[model samples]
Every structure is written in structure tokens, then in C-alpha cells.
Target chain A: MQEELFAPGHRGCAGCGAAIAARLILKGSGKDVIIVSPTGCLEVISSPYPESAWKVPWIHSLFENAAAVASGVEVALKSLGRKDEAKVIVIGGDGATIDIGIGALSGMLERGHDITYICYDNEAYMNTGIQRSSSTPYGASTTTSPAGKVSFGENRPKKNLPAIAAAHGIPYVATASIAYPKDVIKKVKKAISIEGPKYLQIHAPCCTGWGFDGSKTIEIGRLAVETALFPIYESTEGKVTSVKKVKRKPVEEYLKAQRRFSHLFKIEGGEEELKKIQDIADSNAKQFGLDQ
Target chain B: MEIMEGSRAVAEAVKACRPNVIAAYPITPQTHIVEEIARMVADGELASEYVRVDSEHSAMSVCVGASATGARTYTATTSQGMALMHEVLFNAAGLRLPIVMTAANRSLSAPINIWNDQQDTVSERDSGWIQLYAEDTQEASDMIIQAYKIAEDHDILLPVMVGMDGFILTHVHEPVELCPQEKVDDFLPSYDPAYYLTPKNPLSFGTIVYPSTYTEFRYMIHEAMKRAERKIIDVASDFRDKFGRHYGGLIDTYEAEDAEVLIMAMGSVIGTAKDAVDELRSDGKKVGIVKVRCYRPFPAEAISEAVKNAKAIAVLDKNISLGYEGALYTDVKSALYNENGPLALGFILGLGGRDITKNTIKSIAEKAQKAIKSGRVEKDSEFVDVGVL
Candidate 1:
């Protein structure tokens, strides 16, 4: 109810997790924040020339330069003696954050600009119809990484962007899920309050791209956290300070809920692939102490 | 007047403009300018946020963001750096950011050349930014101040690139009368944009344009470019009135009115062409020089009017469009398509730092005279001073 900064009537699909994240993010940051978004699903759906869904100041430049753009906005405010007037934030997707925009993101983090960069991680490039991105999970079938007779699905593991972000020696880095609205809002508020660059990656599931019921978006996100496949945690200055621990559920429970992983139940040699995926989750749990 | 390197003069001029933010990635010949700016910022001579970006793409992107945020922004890069910024250049212009940049004109590379040529900026002619070429260090310094005035005009809210020959002008020492801070503050007032990214209004910028209205947006940009032609001229007139120095409006001419043949060029080569014209006149050759200062909004009418009485024209281009003739030659011919114009010939020279001496200008004049005597061109385009491999 916090002023509904991300207004309704946007073109986001029903039960869109990124749409929910955008609203929750603005709710926490309030009106005195400028948002910079690259070319992604949220940018396309929210801003259509003469119409806009955002009540806060926002800008969308190119597909891979949101961090750099936000850097400019932050520095401009500082230069104009209005640094305290607004907090600059960049809301980009996994593809824009982990792949094409990594250089600019690294630059922004390295330069220590007073901004918070948030990546709504829906795994694949959902804006371009589910092409495989660097953040796409292993064994998850996508448009570009379709499960085939000779291939299982995505061949590589999801890139550990939080760790990469923390490597910059930034003040804060956090990972959250869209299911935990309060947690997402809290982390955003906390990140913005810190001085230098802070990165927050939220696991926002895509019902349309992940081949699941639109109504099950939040449920699927919760499953991802519960199964320990997407560890929810916060690191302050390279040290893990807080984590969302859960009694671990089998990775199959999470994989079985989405059609992207439905192929694993039917295909030959898929059980072994499923075991490999469980090993990945186990490793993540061990790394972040996510298992209760 | 103070004697200083072209790069330092440009930095001094930029300091006087009082930009709110500056972002740039250093490339050869442009490095000295940004480095000088950084020195001034460290010395407290200028109070601007200098963001040292990793690449030229980010540099231009930073300018777009700052300019959209209602801050006057500046940046500079050249050659491969400019090529790397190709897409962002189009984005900045389309967004109507009115960010001013100095393009230390250098040749694009396959052989990896880092020398003076107009090819770098010439390739970006269609990117919707107003392009102005400078003939010397003084003009290059003066144009930076004029560029901001022209670009930040609400009626002509388009980005501008002030092109100076890389190394040739950027590295040379010359006596430049740097404008006083007070005078510049009067000539170019602080940038106050009508639309900007502000929390008070909370508006969105650079939104997605659908096919339903994309063409209309493009057409509006085109219309704005057309309007900027007059704005460029008027700003130049105002600059001359205030500063007591004049670099002609669209095309500056030296004795072109009654000449039998006209020599046309841009950038620092104009200085050499002027000396060549003086010599040609003393020898009764009846030749004059026409300097195309503003390349974009391509000053066709002014060019045609300048060379209307000439029997032939020789256009010296430091940039070639490959497969065809020089880019300026193509534009000049198209400009004269409907008029009883001169028999124009194209001469590509001085590319990749090849020196364009006074002798080169004299020989080009001889070619124009030959075309006049024959009442036709021997060849539409030819490379000047090519030696055997």
C-alpha cells in the first residue's frame, strides 16, 4: 500500500514475479529514488512511449549499460549538490546483469558509486523468449538450451553473481526470492542505506518462460528457496552475515513443479542428471549453510 | 592571448563552460585533453564530477544519463573509441540529450593507425548529432563553447561533436585567446532543460517506442536537425558579436565569389588551403578556398551559393566512403544536382596522417583548373599522391 509507485495497468503477464519485485522495491525505496533500467522485460512492459507505469523518476537507456547510466545519475546528483535528494538504483534482469552488462556493472562496483544494483533473476533471457543466459540453471531447458536426444539442457551451472559482486569488496551483497516480499523489501532498504555500491540479486521466477502456471509464480519461488537450489543470503563486506535456512526438500520437488524440468522425468539418463542437479543444490546448501 | 597546446586550450575552454558532469575514456590524441581536465579538477580550478569510464560506450552512456538528469555533460574520444561507441552515439542523439563531445578526429584502423583524419566522425554522419570541424587550435577551442550553446538550445536539443584533426590540432601549440570565465558565463548560460529526470516531476525517459509512433519520433528528430541549421548560423553570429572572432556560419569562404576554380575542404587543412589560395592569387590563378565548417545539416544551399560562379570545384577529403568517392564530394554533387553548378571533382588526400602540404593544395588546384579547361572532369574521384607499394 506504500503509495503504489509501480502502478497497475502494466503489460506484465499475470503473476509476473519481476512485476511484483518492482512494486515491492519501490515500496521500500519510496518516492525519493531514481530507477535506471536496461533493455529488459520490466523496461519494455512498464514504459511504452506516451505511457509509463512508474511514479518515480526512471530511465531506460540501452540493453547493457544500466549500471553505467546509474553511475552517471549518481555522480550528476553529487555534482549538482543534490546527492541527498534521491537514491539512485539500477533494476536489471539476469541477462543484463550477469552477461552483457557485467563489464559496466564491474566498473560501477569498482568505482564505488553510491547506488544499489538489483538483478531480478528469472534465470534465462525471458524478455527475448527464454534464450539461455549465463544465469540459467544447469539442466534447465530453455529456447536456446532445449533438452535433446544428445543433450540434457543447459550445460553450465548458474554463474555465482553474488560472490562475484562481493569480490569487488563492496559494502553489501544480498540474494532474495520474490516469495519473501518483506525480506526483499528489507534487503533493498538496507542496501540503499549503505554508502558505496551494493548489489542485490532477487530470484524472481518466470511462469511464462519457466513453463509453469502463472498463479504458481510465488509458490515456485518459495520452492526454489526451500529446495536450497537458490540460496537466500546476505553478505556484508565479503562475509556471510545472514541466510534463510530451511529444512531441505529434494531438488526433484522443485524441478517437478516446472515444465522446463519436466523433461527430466521422461528422458533417458535424466535421473543421473537429476542427481547432478541435487549435488549442485547440496553444494549450494553447504556453501551458504542453507540446510536447517 | 596565451600560447598553449591545442589539448590544453580545449581543456581550458571546457573548464570555462562550467559543465556539471564529464565522463570520458582516454584514446590517443584525446588523452591530453581529458588528462588536463582531470588535473584542473584536482587543482580545484573546475568543480565537475569526472567519471573515468572503462570504455567509450560507457563514456557516452554516462553523458546520456547526466544530460537527461538536467546536467550539462561533456566527453571526448577518437578513432576505435568512437567506433566502439557507435550504438550509444545513436541512442544519445535519439534521446535528445544535448551532450557535447570533442571528437579528436583520427582514422579508423585495420593497419592500426592513430593519426589525424576526418574518417572517424565522418562515418557517424547519420547518427543525428550536429558535426562541426575546426580549422586550427583557436577555432577548436572556440567551437567547444559554441557547441554547448547550440546543442543546449531547447529548440535544437541534439548532441554535437566538435571535430579537430587528431594530433594535427590536438597536439599542436598555438596562441589561443581563451575566453574569460565571466564572458563565457554570459555567452553560454547554465543549461536549464525543459524536461529532465527529477524526483519532483518523476517522469520516464528513453521509453520504448512502438511502430505505431516510431516514425513520427524519427521525423521529429529530422525536423529538429533542419531547424538546427538556422540555430548554428545564428549562434555563430552571436558568438562573433560577443567574442570578436568569426568562423563563418555554415561554410566560410575566402575569395570564392569571383574565382574561376574553388578549392573545398574542412578541418585544419583549411589553414593550408588559405595559404595556397594567397599564392595562387599572386600568380594570377584566380582560385579561392571554401571551408565547410558544419558538415551535418549539410549546408548544401550555402555551399552552392559560395561556389555558384566558379567553373570547377576540387573537394579535398581526408575520408573516403570506400566503393564510391569522398563523402563530401558525394554530398557536394547532390547539393548541386538541380543547379547550374561547377564541374566538381573529388580528391582523397591526407588520410591516416599523410601530410597535406601547400604543394598538395597547389596540385589539387591544378586539377580543378584542368577540369575547367576541358569543361568536364577527367575522373569523378582520384586518390592524391599515391606511391607504388
Candidate 2:
């Protein structure tokens, strides 16, 4: 309807999950939105000065202040009597959302600003050449947290951002994936319609960073949700209202697909770590009631 | 003129300036300023969006957001709070958002002291902000209105930080003549930026700049700072014309003319220094004080002119550059570099809220007198050992 708010012809890698997710996010937001993006892959690949891929109004200031900037834009509009008309939206990567930008993000939510924050969580710091972020899943290999002789890659499980954001008592919080493009769009749209601070974290598989075939990005994202590695769910007013039901496949169906987790399957005694990851998935399933 | 707390005076001035948005986090000395503004907002006296952010970084970030959208935004903080705001400070300036902030100057920590010092604002000297320091409570109140005018000037759309000594200027009650809102309205018009965030006319801000273009944008900020020096002076002149009060544009002087020894300092210490200088002048020892009001632009030419004739110059600094000397002493010394000026001495005093009595300042003046007589730079960096707590 709005002639593609985020047009093609940019530096996003072919088969980029973030690129697809960003495009759909704009569609969900329609045209009446002021977007704030932090320093990340989307910021680098889309906006390069005189030439920009973003057709809508957008700003990228620092690594961790997009939420703060969006909050400012929200109030500025309120001050000018335009708050009800235009919505404030912030899009950032997991590093900007879960790591460095967490403080400002928490502030934006706790203050109950009317902003829809969408974190394109590609698991690691992909913009800076495949470094590990808190959102990186357990047993996944990243440049910073590589699978060494004694190490089985990233030692910690991915940070549960949806749960964390839900704890803020904001109106809405959801987790979606690029595999379900319509689901992603629906969740973002629902978030935008909410009255106060809302968070939507999309699981975007990084083709280049995650050592996967470029074509398998979407397929792998679907497997992540299917295997309960990234359980898709929605929460309202801090309560888990719904969760994406799955047949509950083993974690290997997800981990074996990506070379980042190959060490856990190949190395001797790696089954112990694999079992640990399975336990993590099982725990997430129990927390969000994904198995039911 | 009524006896009002310095924080209340600043709050009244901000109210008179009529900011559309005020967002800040609480910190020592600076808390009361925001508290008063909050009370005003609650009472419906100040019709503004007062956002209570979680931290100083968010406070500044919120201001940047509000300012970018063409709203008159204001915030206040001190010390570590200012340090927390250091990153967003650059974002506001780099985006060319004209937000006004009052940093009630307080010391930084390790030993965790939270009293008066210029260390916080001084550390952010290179943050691309127009840093203005105030000498007293009245100047602190008056400068906030003047800061809004200077910052929002289209030609000089840069953020301005008005710094006042922590506790000394903020907590102290002083007689202040609050500018009427009618006059303040005439002085500072509503904020209407050349560009803003609107769906109808969208423009990108804070985009990452490549090396090919980054330097030029930074060069523009530098150029804006240079323009701000003149803008600050003109706005101060305009404010003085309207209100019958004068804040010497870049740097304020107290008997610096025809003096043999000149002492340079900033913040509330200037009052004590002035008293010491007058006592020395009456006793027939030539000494005067140069109150540094605009710190960021450094007011290089103005500072050189003020201290050019003095035979001996001593700088009283509450901040140390750690192994290097006082930050202001370094700047003042650099200002006189091209003029073959007198060897200026750096005196570090009153750090972490040490009381700088008239005796301490007189002793500093006496040292300057001694430097003038001996025609030698005796102490390169003097700590002025004021016996510990």
C-alpha cells in the first residue's frame, strides 16, 4: 500500500534474515512511524549517507541509545501535539538490545514510553565480524567465544529478552522469527497498537556469521522455533498469554544444521554439552509452556 | 529581588524560558533543581513533558530525542551523573540538537566524594558542547536563560552546558532578581529547528559517517563552536540589555585591568578570589581575578587579552589533569602561548569541596605577588596543602 517503505538495493547480504525482517517490520509499522536504529548491521547495511535503503524516517545515533532517542522523539511529538498521530519505533541488533543498550532500553520501558522496540536478534555481533553477544545460544561458536580445545564454544545460553522485557510490566512483549514472516509482522503490528512500551525480538539467522548456507537462513530459523531452541511466544502485562506449539524435535535438528554448533556433536564428550543444551531447551519449554 | 535557593533560581529561570520538555535523573546538588522543576510541572505552572529517566545517560538521551523533534528540552545533573551523560553529550551536539543542560559541578570518585568540583564538566571539555561556568548563584540563574538563546540560535545550533559549583551555588540561598516571563519570552522565542522528525518531511539524523565525510561534519561542529563564541557574547549582550544585568560575554573580569598579578579560576571560588584581590589592591599589591565563564570555547583571544598585561598569572583549579596539571591551567597557559605571555602557575585547590577561604585565596595572591617580584616561576604546579579532614 505504501510502495515499499524499505526498498531493496542496499548492502545487506543476500539471504539476510535481518534484511527480510526489517522489510516486514516497516510493512507492519505502515508509514506513520519515526524509526530509531542503533549502531548495528541494519544501520551499516541500509544507511550509508546520500544513499539510504530506508524509505521511512529513520535515525541512528549511538550503539546503545536508540530506545532513549525514540523516547525523546515520542515526547517531542507529544509536546508538539503529534504524539497520537505518529508512532515511535526502535530497531536494533541483540548486541544493542541485550548488551550495551540494555540500560537505556530498560529505562525506556520502565518510564512507560509509547514505543515499539524491535530487536533483530541474529544471536551475535554480526556487524562487527561475528563476535559473541549475550543473545548467542549455548554451544555456538563465535569469534570471541570460539570452540577451543577445552571449550565447547559459547558457554552460556541465550539471554531471554522477551521474559526480561515482560518483567518491566510493559503492555506487550513477544518473540518471533523470520521463518514466520507473517507472524513477525503480526506481532510487530500488535506491539505498535499497544498504548505503552512494547518489545518484539525477532530471531534472524545470520547466514555469513553463523556459518550456514545462504539459502538455509529461513529454514534454519524455522528449525530453531520447531526445536524449541527459540520458542516463539507472546506476553501481555507480564503474563505469558500464548506460545507457539511445536511437535518438540530434538535440539540436534537445530544445532546440526549450523557449523557453529558442530563441535558439540563432533568432539569427544561433546554429547554432555549437547545434553546440557537439550536441558536448556527443555527449561525454556517449561517456562513458556512451549511443549503444551 | 528575593532571597531564593540557587536551585530554585535556576528552576525559575528554566520555567521562564518555557522549555517544552525537561528530563533528568537525580544526583547530588543537581537533584533539587530537577525537583523544583518537577514540582512546577506537577502544579501546572510549567506545561512541559517532564520525564524521569533511570540514569543520566537516559536523561541526556531523552533530551536529544526531544530536541531533535524541534522541542525546547532541558535537563540537569552533576559529577558521575555528568560522567554518565558524557557519551550522549556528543550525540546531542553531533546531531546539532539545541538542548540546554545545567551541570551542578561536583567531584568524581574513587574515594567516592560527592561535593563541589569542576572535574565532571572538565572531563567532557572535548564533547563538542558549549561549556559555560557560572561564578555565583545569580549568574547561574541568569546564564540558563542566556544559554537557551545561545544554543537555539540557528547559526549556532549546539548544546550548551551551564556549570555551577555543586552545593556552593546550588544549595546556597542568595538574593536573585528573576526575569519576568514576558521579557524572557521576548528574549528566547519558541524552538523551531530547520529540520525535525516528521513523516510528512522526513530527514535522517545521527547517521554513521564514513571517513570521507566524518571529518567535514566534525569540522562543521568546530566551526559551530567558533560561531558559538560570538553568539554567546551577542546573546549575553542582548540579555543584559533586556534585564539590566551583564555577564561578560566569554570571560568575566574582576579588576584584571592594569594589574601586575592576575589569578584565573572558575565556579563559586571567583567570589572569594575577588574579595582577596580587593584586599591586596587596597594594600598596594596589584592583583586581580579572571572568572572563566565560557570554558569549552576557552575564549582564547579574550583570555589572552585579559591576562596579557599582568606580569604574573596564577590559575586556581579545583580539578587536576592527573600527572598533567590543572585542566584550566593547561588551557590558560595554551591561550598565552602565541603572545610570549608571562609564565602562568597552576594552583590546584578546594578539590572534593575543600573550603577556599579568603586566607587561602590571599595566600595564592601572595604567591602570585612573590612570583612577580622574583621574576621566576617558583612552583610549576602547587597543590596548596590545605590540611586534611
Best by TM-score: 1
- lDDT per residue, candidate 2, A84-111, as tens digits? 7688999999999999999999999998
Question: Which lDDT values do the candidates have, in the order given?
Answer: 0.94, 0.89
Positional deviation of residue B349's Cα in model 2 after best superposition, in angstroms: 0.6
Highest DockQ: which candidate?
1
Which pairs clash in model 1? Answer: none
Fnat, 2 decimals, each candidate: 0.75, 0.73
Candidate number with greatest lDDT: 1
**Over all chains combined, what TM-score does candidate 2 have?**
0.97
Q: Find the 10 residues in a row with the least total lDDT in model 1 chain B.
A: B367-376
Candidate 2 lDDT tens digits, B1-389: 99999999999999998998899789998989999999999999999999988788888988888888889999999999998888889888999989999999989997899898889999999999999999888999999999989888889899999999999999999999999989988888888787888888777777767898999999999999999989888988988899999979898888878888888988899999888888888999788888888998879999998888888888989999998899999998888888989768889988999899989888877887787778888888889875668
